[model samples]
Target chain A: MKTIWFHLMPYPELPDDFTDEHRSVWVDIDPALFDARVGHRMYNEYIDELEFAASVGFDGVGINEHHSNAYGLMPSPNLIAAALARTCPDAALVVLGDSVALYNPPIRVAEEFAMLDCISGGRLVAGFPVGTPMDTLYAYGNNPATLRERYHEGIELILKAWTADDVFSFNGKYSKLRYVNCWPRPAQKPHPPIWIPGGGSVDTWEWCARVGYSYLYLSYFGYKAALKTMQGFWKCVEDAGRPANPFQAGFAQFFGVADSEAEAIELYREPAEYFFNRCLHVYPGFADPPGYKTLNTVRNGAEGMVERAAREANERAAQAAKKAERKAAQQSFSAASHMSFEQMVEKGYVIVGNPDQVAEKTVEMAKQLRIGHVMSLCHFGNMSRDLAMHNTELMATKVLPQIRHLWDDEWEDEWWPQPLPASDRVMPSPRPTVSR
Target chain B: MIDLAQWKAGSLEIWREGEGRTVGYLHGMVCAPGRQPFVTELASRGFEVVAPSLPGYSRTAPSDDIRNIHDWVFALSEIIDVAGLAGAPMVASSTGAMLALELAAVRPEAFSSLVLVAPLGLWRDDLPVADPFSTTLSGQRALLTKDPTTTALFFEDHESGDALVDATIQRYTARTATASLVWPLPEFGLSQRIHRVSCPVTLVWGSDDQIIDPSYADSFAACLRDVRGRHVVNGAGHLAEWDDPSAVASIAASALN
Candidate 1:
C-alpha cells in the first residue's frame, strides 16, 4: 500500500467565541480575523510538515485547493506543489488540484499542470475534483447547472492540449481556444496519473472506471458510512470489465497515534473536535445550490435509483421508511461537532491508538475497503507543529513500514506518480512566445 | 382555484384561470396561490389570467439543459405559445419580470404591455441587491411577505410522509430552477438591453420590499423607451400581490385601461 501525508492547514487561532459569533467558517469568514503575521508563520510551518513527510519516506505529499476557506489555507495548491517540488525531491506532489471548470479558457489548467510536472521531474498525481458547491458556484460564481458540464469539457480540452502531437483548434461548450497547445509538456509522457476525488457521484464513478483512472473517495464519513460508495465504485469498475486492482481506489482517513490509546485520544481530541465543529460549520444554504446536483445524479444514483426500483416493484410502503433512514445516515458525519473522544474512536471517524495498534487497524480497514492508497491526514484541524510532526513520524516510521508491503507483490501500482530518474530528468525553461 | 394544465415538451403543469381579455401572468420565483387574491381580483375586473406554474414549480419537468438567460428566454417564449398568448399583455413578478424584460427586449412584439413587479435584473455596485438564497427559510419568508401571518396562512406546514416529501420536492425544484437565473448574483446584464423593449412598460414595487429595494423600480423604469413610470404599493414587500392584492390589481387595472 502507498501512504500519503495530506495537510488541511487550518488556521488554529480562531477565538473561543468564534462558533457563537460567526455564522460560517468558509466563504463569508471575516477577513479582519486573519493575522497576516500568523499566516506567514503557518505557511512556513505547514510546508515544513509536508517536506518532513517526504523526508521520512512517505510515498506522497498532497495539498488540495479551497478558496476563501479558513480550514484549508491552500487556495492555490500548485503554489505549494511548486514549493514542495524544490524541497521534497522524491515523493509524489499530489496537486489534487485546481478546479478546472473555474478557469475560462481551460488551457490554463493544462499549462499549470504541465509546469508542475516539469518542475517536479514528473512527480505529479493530477487530481480533478468537480469542486465543492461552495468553492465553484458560490465563491467563484460558476453556474451550478453548468459547472459539471464545464468540468467535463475542461478536462477534455486539457487532455487534448497536453497530448495532441500538433497544435489544434478546439471549440468546446465552455471553452474556445484558437490554438490548443501546451508548451513545456509534462515530463511524464502522455500525462501523469489522473485521480478523481469524488463526492460520491455516480457519473464520477463510471467515468473513473471507464477511463483507467483511480477513484479517491474523499469522505469525512468513515469506512462504515463510505462502504456502499467504495463497493459501488468497484462494481462500476467490474461492470466496465476492468480489473479490480485495489490500487485504482484511494481513501482518506483521519488517524492519530501515540505511545498508548489514552495518549492518542488526549493528543488528538481538541483538533478533531475543532475540525468537526468549527472547520465544517458551513451554512446549509451554501452546501447545495438547487441545480448543483445534476438531474442524472438525482435520477440515476443511489436514492433516486432505489426509489424508482421500489416503486416499480410496488413497494411504495418500504420506500418512505428507507428515505427517513438514509437521511439519518447522511447526518452521521456531524458526530465531529462537539464529539467526545470515545465517539470519534468508536465511530472510526479518526482511528486512534498506539503505533502498533494503529498500524494493525489501518491494514484491517484498508483490506476491508480494498483501497491500496491511503491519504492519511495525521495532522488535522488545529494540531500544533510538534504534535503533527510526532504524529507524522509515527505514521511514517511505525504505521507505513508495517503495511506498505500489502499487495506490493500482487499488483503493479500504476496510479501513483513516477518520479523520473535524476540522470534522465530534464526541466523546462520559461520563454516568451512572439505573437504574429 | 385554478386548474393545472399539462404541456408536451415535458410533463410540466401550468396554471390557467379567468376569462375575457387575456393577461399573461408570469409568477414570481414561487407559484403559491394560497389566499393570494390578485388572480380573482383580475378576473372580477374582466381580464383572463394565464398564470403559468412554470416548469419545475408544479411537479413538471424543467428543461435540465437550460444553462443561461438565452435558454430561459426560449423556454418561456415556448410557454407563451403553449398558453396561446403570443401577443398579450404580460404581468411578471420578481424573477419572471426579469425574464419578461429580456424576452420583450429580444422579440419586441411578444407583449402588448409589460407590468413588471419588483423585477430582479439590474445590478448597482453602490446599491447591491440582498441575496435571497443565502438566507434561512424564515429569513426568506420575512423578505418576501411583510406579514408573518400571511406566510403561515399560505404555507402551513401540517404535512407528513409522502405529502411532506412531495411539497418539499416541489418547493426545492422550483428554487433550484430559479438559481439558474439568479445564483451567485441576480444580474444577467438586462440593464444593457432593457432599453430595447418596444412595449409600454409599467414598473410595480412594494414600498417595503426587503428582498429588492423599491428604489430599483425607478432605475429600471428609466431605462425603457416607453415606461409608464414606477408604482410603489403601500404596506407590501417583494411579493406585493400577496400583501395588497387589490391595490396591485387597482394599479395594474388602471395602467392596463
Candidate 2:
C-alpha cells in the first residue's frame, strides 16, 4: 500500500479594500481593488508556501482554473503550474487541468504539459477535465451537443500528440488538425500521469478506468456525497474487472486546522460563509448550457436546483407579500428567520477543527471511500493569507504525519523520483551558524 | 411544399422553392401554428429558416429525460449538417438565442452569421426579477411585465385562452429557467470565449425589455470580440420580434445581407 499523498491549493484572497453591499448580486466584484503589484507579491508568496509544503514533505501541490469569478482568481492554472515547476523541487505540479473542451486546438495543452514536464524533470501530473456544464457551455459558448465529443476528441489529440513519434493529421466531429507534431515530449516515458477530475459523471468514470487514468472526485458538497460517487466509481471498476489501484483514485475536501476544534470552527465560520453563501451565488441561467447535459446531471437532477431557486424566489415573494400584508408581520418574519451556525454544520458543507480531529475524520472518510490521495483545501473561502499559511503549516507538521503511519506500507516508494545525478543536481548555499 | 400549419403542429415539415428559398423553424415550447408566421416571414425575406422543437418542447415528444444544453446543440448541429446549410446564417430569439450563439461559437464553419434576440444566459446579480420558470405564471407575469397594461399585450393575439397560454408559458419558462439556474455560472463563461467565434454576430435588444436589461448589450459587445453590430429597438421588451416584428425582421435582414 502507498502512503497517502496530501496536496494543498490556496485560493488567493481579494484585497480588503473591495466592498459590495450587494455582494450577493451578480458574480461581479470591482477588479480595481486588486493591486497588481500586491497580486505579483501574493503570487510569489503563494508559490513560496507551495514550495514550503514540498520541503516539509507534501506529495504534491495543486492548482485549478476559474474565469471572471472573484472566488478563485486563477483563470490559468498552467501559469501557476509553470511557476511551481521552478520553485517546488520534489512535489508533483498538478494542474488539475486545462479544460479540454474549452481549448480550440488542445494540442497547445500537449505542448505546454510537455514543456512543464521537461522543466520539472518529470514531476508533472496532467489533468484533463470535461469541465462544469456552466463553465463549458455558458462561459465558453461551447455547443452543449459537441461538448463530450469535443472533449473526448481533444483528449485523443492530446494523448496522440504526447505519445506519438510521427506527425499526424486528424479530423473529427469537433476538431481537425493537420500535421500534429508536438516538440519537447514529456519527460515521463508514456507521458506524465493523467488525472481526470469529474463531478459524478458515469462516462468519465468508465473512461478513466478504461484508460488507466486517475479519477479525482472534486466534492464541493461534502464527504457523504463524495462517498457515494467514489463507490459508484469502484463499482464501475469492478464491473470492468480492472484491478483496483489505490494510487489511481483520489478525492478533495475543504479543511481547516487549528489549536482546538472549537477555535478552528470559530476561525473558519466567516470564511466558510463567504465560500458557500457569497461565492455560490451563480445566476441559475449559466449552469446548464445546451449539449453539456450528462446522465449524472440528470441523476443529480435539476429538481434540486430548481427547487432551491424556486424556494428562494418564493421566499422573497412571500416576504414581499408579508410586507404588503402587514408591516408587523414582515418584522415578525424577519426576526424569526435566522439560520444558526449549528444548522450549517448539520448541513456538512464545511469541516473545521484541530489537527487531531480533522485527521481522524479524514482517515475515517478515506477508509469509507477507499480514497488514496486527499487534496485538502486548507486555504479556502476568504481565509486570510496568514491564516491559510498557518493552516497549511499545521496540516504538514501535525495532521499528515499522524496519518502517515497508518498508510506507510500501503504504496511502494518506487513511484517517487530518485535522487538526481551529480551532474544534474545543484547544492543550496550554506548558511552561517548563530548561537543564541 | 411544406405546410406551415402541419409543421407548427409538430410534424417534420420542410419547404423548398417557396419564395425561392428553404427554411426550418422549431416552434417555441408548445407546438402552435400561430408561431409559424415568425418562420414564414423570414422565408419571405429570401432566407432559409430552420427550427426544430426540442425534445420536451413544442409538439415534439418529450425525451425520457430532460437533457442539458448538449442535447439541443447536437440535434441542431445534425440538422444543419444534413441540410447542407452549414454556411447559412441563423437567427435565434429568446431561448433559441442561446443555442444559436453556442452553435456559431462551437462550429463557426457551419454559420455565416449569428443573430440573437433577447438571448438567455445574461443574468446580472443586480436584476430584481426571479427566474421565469421557478415562479408561478402570476409570479412570472409580475416580474416580466413592468405594468399591468403591458401584461395584456402578451395575450392580445394568442388564440389560446389566457389560462391555457399562461400555463404553457409557465411550464416552458420553468423548465428552461430552472435548467439554467442548476449549473454554475463559470460553466457559461462564453463571454470570454466569444472572441474565439469566427462568424459575425449581431445582438438585438428590446429597449423596454422587462425580463433582461438593455445594459447587458454592453456586456455582450464587450465579451463577443467579433460582433458586427448591436441594435436596441425602442418600445419593445423581451419579445421584441413579436412586439415589433417589422423592426426585428429588418435588423435580421440587415445582418443577413
Candidate 3:
C-alpha cells in the first residue's frame, strides 16, 4: 500500500485576543489577521515538510484547497503542488484536487495540471472535486442548481483539453471556449491519473465509477462515518463491474504517533478539535445554498447536525439566562472541553499511539477495507514543525516499511513511470560552480 | 403588442406583464398597491415593464418552499418564457436586483440589459446598517425613507390605516424574509463573468440609500464591463422608484435606447 501524508499545518496563534472561550463562540473568523502573521510561514513550512516527506520515502504528498478559513491556509493547492513539483524529485504531488466549477475557464486547470505533470516528470494525481456547498455556492457564488452540470462540463472540457492533440471548441451551458489547447501537455500520455474526491454525493460516486476515475473518501467525520461512505463507493464500483485497480481507490485519515498511545492521544486531541470545531464553523446557510440544495445536506439527517449545535447553544443560552449564571457555565464549558487525547481516539477522528500500534492499526484498517492507498495526516491543526518532522521520520522509518511489506512485493508496475523518448526528455543542466 | 397579465410559475403566482420591450419587476418585501405605479411609470416611457410579485408579496402566492435566489430566477425565467419575452431587459429592485443579476449570469442571452436598484446581496463586514426588517413600522420608515416628512407623505398615499400598515410590516417580517436574507446568492463568479455578458447593463441607485451604500455602485460599474450607464436619484432611500418615480422612469428609458 502506498503511504501519502496530508498536512493542513494549522496556525498556532489566533489574532483575536479572545481566549478559547471567545474562539468557540463563533465559527466565522476574520481572515485579515489570519493572513497577516502566520500565512507565509505556514506555506513555506508546509512545502518544506512535504518535500522532506518525499526524501524520507513517503510515496506521495497531498495538498487540498479551502477558501476564507484559517483551518486550511491553502486556498490554491495547485500552487503548492507546483512548488512541490520543483522541490520533490520522486514523490507524487497530489493536488487532492481543484474545485472544477469555481474556474471560469476550467481550461486553466487543464493547462496548470499539464504543466505540473511535465515539471514533476508525470508524478501528478489530478483530483477533481465537486466542492463543498460552502466554498462553491457561498464563497464563489455559483448557482447550486447548475453546480453538478457545470462541474461535469468543466471536467469534460479539461479532459478534452489534456488529451486532444489538436485544438477543439466547446460550447456548454456554462462554459464556451473558442479554442481548446493546453500547452505543456502532460508528460504522461493520455494525461495523468484522475482522482475524484467525493463528499458522499450519490451522483458523484456513480459518476466517478462510470468514468473509471479513482474515488477518494476523505475521512472528515469519524471512522464509522467514513466506513459507510467508503462502502457506498466500493458498492458503486462493484455494481459497475470495474476491476479494482489498486490505485483506483484511497482514504485519508488523521494520524499522530508518540512514544505511547496515551501520549499520542494527548498530542492529537486539541488539533482534532481545532479541525472540527474551528475549521468546520461554516455559516449554516452557506452549507447548502438554495439552488445546489441536495437531499443529503438538506434532509432530516443533515439538518440534525445543525440542530444539535443550535440546541447546545440554546441550552447554554438558557443556562446563561442570568448574566452571572451564563458567565459561570461558559467558563466551566471552556475549561472542561479542553479535548483530551483519549476522547479524540474514541471519536475516531485520529489514529494516535506508538509507532508499532499505529502501524498495526493502520494495516488492520487497510486490510479490512482492502484499500491500496493510505493517506495519513500527521501534521494537523497547530502542530509544531519539529513535532511534525519527528512524526514523519517515525512514520517513514518504522511504520511504512512494515505496512508496505503486507502488500504483494511482485513489483506491480501498473502505477510505475513509463519510459520517455530521448527526444521528449530534458536532462537537468549542470549546477554552476561556486567558490567555497 | 405587449400583453400584460398575471401568470403562474410552478406553485407561485407571478404578476407578469409586458411583451415588445419587456422589463421584469422585482418588488421590495413590503411593496403595496402603489408598487404598480412604478410599472405604469415605466410603461408610459414606451417600455413594457412586468413587475412580478415576489413569492410572498402582493397578488403572488406565498411559497414556503422557495429557498434561494436562483429559485426566484427560475420563476422569473418561466414568466419570461411564458410571455415570449426571453430576449428582454430586466429592471429588478432590492432583493429582485440579486435575482436579475443571477438570471443575467445564468442565461446572458435572455436580456438586453439589467437594471439593479439598491440590490441587497453584497454585505460588507464593516457596515453599520442593522437588520432592515428588525425595527417597528416607524423605525423601518425612519431607516428606509431619506426624508421623514417625505416618507410620511408616501405612507399617507399608500398606507390606508394602522391595521394595513401593521399587516404589511408583519408580511414583510415572516420566515420568507428570513429565507431571502439567509438563502445564498449564486456564486456565478459574476465579478469575472460580467465581462462575458453580451448585452448592456444599467445600475440604478438611490444616492442616499441606506440599505446598500452608493459606494458599492462604483464596484458594480467597474465589474460590469458592458454597463451602459449608472444613474443615482437624489433624495431617495433604498426604494428609489417609490421615492422619485420620474427619475427611475428616465433611467429605464435611457437604457431602452
**Global lDDT of each candidate:** 0.80, 0.62, 0.66
**Model 3 docking grade:** incorrect
Considering summed lDDT, which 10 consecutive residues are worst modelled in model 3 chain B?
A: B170-179
User: Which lDDT tens digits does candidate 2 get at residues A232-300?
Assistant: 788888877877666668777777789998888788877775555445444444444333545444544
RMSD of 3: 10.4
Off by over 4 Å in 2: A1-28, A299-345, A405-436, B1-257
**Global Cα RMSD, each model:** 7.4, 9.9, 10.4
Model 1, C-alpha of A40: deviation from truth (Å): 0.5
Across A1-436, the per-residue lDDT of candidate 3 in tens digits comes to 8888887655656532323334322234554455554677877787778988888999889888766556666678888888888777777777878999998889988988888888877888888988765567556756555566788889999989888879989997678889887897988888788888766666566777788787777755546446666676778788899765555677887788888877876666766666554444433333433334343333212332222333343344344455445455545443343344466577666877899998888887776565677778888767777878888888898889888865566334244334245566554567999999
- C-alpha DockQ of every model: 0.39, 0.08, 0.08
Best by DockQ: 1
Lowest summed lDDT window (length 10), candidate 2 chain A: A17-26
| Chain B TM-score, candidates in order | 0.93, 0.71, 0.77
Stronger candidate by TM-score (1 vs 3): 1
lDDT of 1 by residue, A1-436 (tens): 9999998889988876665567677779899989999899899999999999999989999889888888888888989998998888788988778889887788888889999898889999999988887788778988776788889899998888889999999977667778887998998878988999877678888999999899998876566666888898899999999998999998889999999999998999999878766676666546656666765465543432212222222232234346546675553222312446577678787999999999998888888889998989988888989999999999888888899999889898989887778897754445679899
Tens-digit per-residue lDDT, B1-257, candidate 1 = 44544565576455565678888778786546322578777767888877776667665677755878888888888878777777999888998899999999898999999898899999887788877766556667787878755655335556777676666566667777777778778888888888889999899999999878888976887788998857989899998887888888888877788
Q: Name the regions of candidate 3 deviating beyond 4 angstroms.
A: A15-28, A35-37, A244-246, A266-285, A293-333, A336-338, A405-430, B1-257
By DockQ, the candidates rank as 1, 2, 3
DockQ score of candidate 1?
A: 0.39
